[model samples]
Target: MNHDSYDDNYIRGILNGVKSIAMVGASPVNVRPSYFAFKYLAQRGYDMIPVNPGHVGKSLLGKPFVASLSDIGRPVDMIDIFRNSSHIMPVVDEALTLSPLPKVIWMQLGARDDAAAERAEAAGLKVVMNRCPKIEYGRLSSEISWMGVNSRTLSSKRAPIPTQGMRLSLNRTSVGGGATTASDRAAKNRSEPT
Candidate 1:
């Protein structure tokens, strides 16, 4: 449970387990890392809820943005923090107020708060600090290796690429809860008027 270093299995477990994620500090600007991460995770099948006070009532990736974590009506398996290190404590405080309480607290790259992490862990939430879920997912699933990026996973056989192209398929069986598969969601999106 060290905040400084996390095992691959621990990171993989979180990326695989969470079905729905409430992304705090999500941005509407495409240039921001949060925006890219939000889009990437959504495309991969996880139901992503955007939580940003300024963008409340706006839509991101087809999902309405909420003012806070409590505004989300359903249970969120993970709360991905994209805020500054100094802001993490309040974010963690807000996450703890949820009814079911998120299963995990993930702090994005360059965002770290040992004190906040400790508080979240003490409250029984699995904590992953200073790691980006998008990066971890790509690395663990071998999707990045296909992009000629070093995913750091070694294997003789290449991971199967989706016939549709570079789009990665969601591991529906590995997804926790009864969340809808990414394929199904993509199909729905396509069938919609857009």
Candidate 2:
């Protein structure tokens, strides 16, 4: 996988597949980008575990913070690294220690370590560098358009109105349209037979 530029499916697949995330360098401060990202993912129904040595015993969005990835005590589908480029390798090395390795190692915006990414990929983990999952999720789900940004996702069909909040669906025929909010999907699930 090209860590420099990721295909939409590559990102979408990772986002859709990952059920739980251990966010390293997560902050308790509400204004921090990591906090915002964590909150958004939690609201979207992803199990978010906060990891930060300094903030251990505290909580971010009510999720208790662990000192490190090893302390999570549960399997996480992805490791979202919120630290700077220089700190990425240590985090990646630590994440690699888990028995069932995470499916992805995602470096936040402005954070990139080619060596670290290469190692993770060689270990059979997908890698994303210098990108923010929050922003990508918003853009890919067309929720960013609500913020007046041109999401570059155009469609002739109208998007399904969200049932609550500003949440949109990751399942789509294209990037912008098809599936609606999570609540709507849940309603459909409740109505359908197994």
* Best-performing candidate as measured by TM-score: 2
Worst 10 residues of 1 by lDDT: 170-179
lDDT of 1: 0.79
Q: For model 1, how does the per-residue alpha-carbon lDDT over 4-59 read when each residue is reduced to its tens digit?
A: 55656677678778899999999999999999999988878788999999998789
Q: Model 1, stretches more than 4 Å misplaced? A: 163-194
| Candidate 2 residue-wise lDDT, 9-48, digit = tens | 7788888898899999998888999989998888877889
Model 2 Cα RMSD, 1 decimal: 11.5
lDDT of each: 0.79, 0.81
Model 2: pairs clashing at backbone N, Cα or C within 3 Å = none
Whole-model lDDT, model 2: 0.81
